[model samples]
Target: METKILPRILIGAPGSGSGKTTVVCGILQALINKGLNIVSFKCGPDYIDPMFHKEALGLESRNLDLFFNDKETINYLLAKNSKEADLAVIEGVMGYYDGLAGKSYEASSYDLARSTKTPSVLIIDCKGKSVSILAEIKGFMELESDSNIKAVILNRISPMIFEEIKKLIEETLPIEVLGFMPMIKECSLESRHLGLVTAQEVGNLETILDTLAKQVSESIDLDKLIRIAKTASKIEFIKPTIACGERVRIGVAKDKAFCFYYQDNLDLLSEFGAEICYFSPLEDKKLPENLQGLYFGGGYPELYLKELEKNDSMKQNIKDALSAGTPCMAECGGFMYLHEVVKDKLGHAYKMVGTIEGESFYADKLVRFGYIDMEAEKTNLLCEEGMHLKGHEFHYWDSTNSGDCFHAQKPLRKMNWKCVIGNENLYAGYPHVHFYSNIKSAERFVDICRKRKTKI
Candidate 1:
């Protein structure tokens, strides 16, 4: 792979709830207003923040997970997506230093910053301490000497105390104080049990984004920030290894219950000429007509168990399609929906699609969490036997029984409450696999669906 140079900026924070999302949204809009073709990304396993990025820039924002996606694929995705864009902005996960099991290899913002060789701008929450802010920035910079910390943006700073903090940071840290935003109460994003409220649920989002962009542009130094981003080192680009013959049309379940899809996955599908059509499992009677494949991403299926149970016909239609050998892929929440029954945290049970002969129950403890290198033990839609794919597993649900129905590889154990399943045509697991890491998986899935169409 040859090196490909592109301007990029990473927006991260000292920790979660530090107003990083607000800062990123403002920066994205500001860049877009400058007529720069901007592409955005989220560091960890999140589907909602990217949505806001998309709305702000009017271009789809993708995700890069050190846990669920491999290094090669991450490089390829950044290279491919950044081809026509003037700049790429990535939002970090949790704290900049937080990682999985205390290891920096997976789920860490620093891991992603290093992997892409992008320069980072720390967004520090300046509430009380003024002069001591320099120490915090120095600690983060020294913690990861390899990472490029170009600038710092102080968020939630009161105008009365802003000059003191800015002067201290400028006098001490080697980096520049790019800008700061006053503590605007209305500018904060709405939140729910999982994370930020889904982008769809927020009504006045456009007005909010526009206001945020205007405010940041008026306060921040855009020219210096752009120069800092341009100074970052470049990464090599790699072409996708997997290819397909014709466009494959896939039906995806996209309701309130199943919405946890990686934007990059959908973008890659489109690149391969796959037409994605969405259907509501909560209302639709059947899958989209003439669909070549079906994908069920993760979401809060447990919360809407009663509504899904009431949609008996849709559940039966999915079960019948699976029984007829349709190529279908289901992730964690999707996996739960395919089971015979799903019991919530309240112990309320509801009937689900019985495509898999098992029952899922919400557990008091998380069943599994962290990165996994999964190798196929048998050929399926995802990959051929022995091919490995990198992904992460995080769920609070556990299965009641294994049964002798589906087959998985060594690392996946039934007793450990990692994987459970139904038929060969149907795959449901806790680990969420980003398609870019294993393009062959999507190719194989589409191939199988096309073959099934030929038989019909």
Candidate 2:
């Protein structure tokens, strides 16, 4: 067992839209301004919020999901990423106690805090009530044996009553009232069908971040926050083992059209000896030379149909590679890009790679949205027959011929369905897989890439 003393604090909310992301970002930038080396983390499988941390603020942000990884891995990931940083800021998902299916606390933020032994700060939305706020905090603290909540931050409250509520809460509850954040209208982030629009889409992103940092520095107590973060104990974990095998070059599609990738997934591949070469299908004219494998993750392909269709050479490049038996793995939006045609919300069709015989169109609503456990019905690139894995599906698009290579069942629900189009060299489907859920699948993919490279 390995142990590391990590100074960390988790920002959790009673539920979503309590301004968790905005608060975390504000605190992160303010800390960075104070010459503190800060590393950020998101609790669950969100790919976008981490982008805000990485792209917008230029800080290294990683995901720590209890659903995809065990406690040991979570601790290892936290310790591994926070090695050179002064503080680690974790932003919780959905709600503090809300976890899988809204029934169990299996993968909740509280679960994560206990597993990693990190201190927590609860941020309550103080819009509608006053004295009732203390009841909410007390209930959360007593709901579980150990809530791990150390402090509180009130959001969307007026400055006039800040001290009034702060004093009342400190007098009533066992937790310390950190500070309050007044609603800054222009600094708020805009949302589309998915959560916040990608950090790149916001026109005034830099200005908004600057405004948030300035506001947070003035409103929030940085000294108290730092003191709480430093109180976190040491984390104990088992180091992961990796195979130092043959090296393989894999071309990964990364751009505005296809940017949904877990940093851990790519890191695991590299740890297993695959040199990832990133290329943009949106701008690149051709695939990288001598690629052993191709990976296209999920992103906003539907929004940029015209631009993707205009890149005729890149589409043909991908189609030709897939046809030649190059190993490939694609999820949600990436699966849509392989279709013969993709229709936007207005029903306008645009040509795509034509690897799949059907077209992808917006479903108007989320289809099969949640966590899923998958069992492969036949042998495929990443697994053998009857093998099981964990993944997630959160997309608003559907394909005309969504394949039936795997049987998927939603956790805690009686629903089961058929999906995926798996073969010896391809695993294209709507379910986004975290490689750590079953590291063997990741290792298998790396081995396949190595074999392909050897043949060439």
Candidate 3:
């Protein structure tokens, strides 16, 4: 095992809606203005918040999920990704203590903080209450023995009584009051069914980031936050060994419609000798030439129904490629696009790639949302029979035939369901697979692509 001191801090909240994303983005923007090479991470399996960190703020962002990786792997990922960077700012998931099945803090932000030995700053929404805010901080600290809550940032608070609130909190509690963020109405991000409308959809995104950056510069204590971040303990872990193999080309669908992808997944594929060929499904008329494999990650394909349907050549090309036994992996929105028909929220119908035998429609509510444990029921492109993988599912659309190639069970719940249409050359499902959870599965995928390349 190797060891190195890593400068890092986690930005957490008492719960969701406490402006964690906004505050994290603001602080990130503020720090970027000072010319620091910052690497950001989002806790758990969220694919959108990291978009803001990477796309909107121009930082290298990745996901750190306790559920997907063990402590050693998590440490290795942090150390590996944080190389030559000034600081690592991790955005926490949900509440500080909320975790798997809402029963324990097994995979919460606290788990990430404690496991990585990274200090955290809690951002509490102080819109209505002032004195009681201290109580909430105290409660969070008291709830866990190793909460690692080093500082607090008050959100949506008035600047008039900032001094009084800071003094009261510092004098009464053990944590430091960094500063407060006044409510900025114009900088608020819009939302749809699947959390914040992706960073690409926000029209005034640059202006919003600029406004938040100004607020963070004037209000937040960046020096103190840096000091706390520097206090992170050294992490030790065995460096992961990714096998190198024959290079092969893999076409990946990437655009506003098909943009939900884990950066590490692509990185891992690259480490295994797969050359990524990125093509747009929204505007492109055909898939990239000489591709051995196809990967389509989750995004808002439903939003671009008309655009996708109008592009008959693209849809036909994808359908033909999949039909010709090209190894493909599609999840959620990608899976939705493979259907013969896709209906919009207003019940308008449109044509899609007819690889999957079904139609997809908006279900009006989140279906099977949260963490899931998947066991392959048969040999497939990425896994052998009985192979297990950790994944997450958060979607409102349901397909007429979701397939029965894998058995999925909710963690901490006895509920079991069938998902994923897996075979020798495909893995299409609603669940998003984190390749880190099962490295061999990803290696198998690369191997399949390599063999296809040689055959071609």
Instruction: Please report, in order, the local distance difference test score of every candidate based on alpha carbons.
Output: 0.77, 0.89, 0.90
Which 10 residues in a row give candidate 1 its minimum summed lDDT? 404-413
Candidate 1 lDDT tens digits, 23-86? 7888888888889988888898777777666644577688888666667778877877787878
Candidate 2 residue lDDT tens string, 1-456: 988987999999999888887778888888998999999999998898887789888999999999888898899999998878999999999889999888989889999999988899988889987999999999999998778999999989999998999999888878898888898876765243136367766788788778888888898898999999989988898887888698899999999889999998999999998899999998889999999999999998987899999999999999999999999999999999999999999999999999988999889999999889899997787888888888999999998888898899988889889999999899999999988888888899989888888777
**Which candidate, 1 or 3, would have the higher lDDT against the true structure?**
3
Model 3 residue runs over 4 Å out of place are: 190-196
Q: How does residue 71 of candidate 3 score in lDDT?
A: 93
Per-prediction TM-score, please? 0.89, 0.97, 0.97
Steric clashes per prediction: 0, 0, 0
The CA lDDT at 444 in model 2 is 90
Which candidate wins on lDDT? Answer: 3
Candidate 1 residue-wise lDDT at 424: 45
User: Candidate 3, residues 322-368: lDDT per residue as tens digits?
Assistant: 88889999999999999989999888889899898889989999998
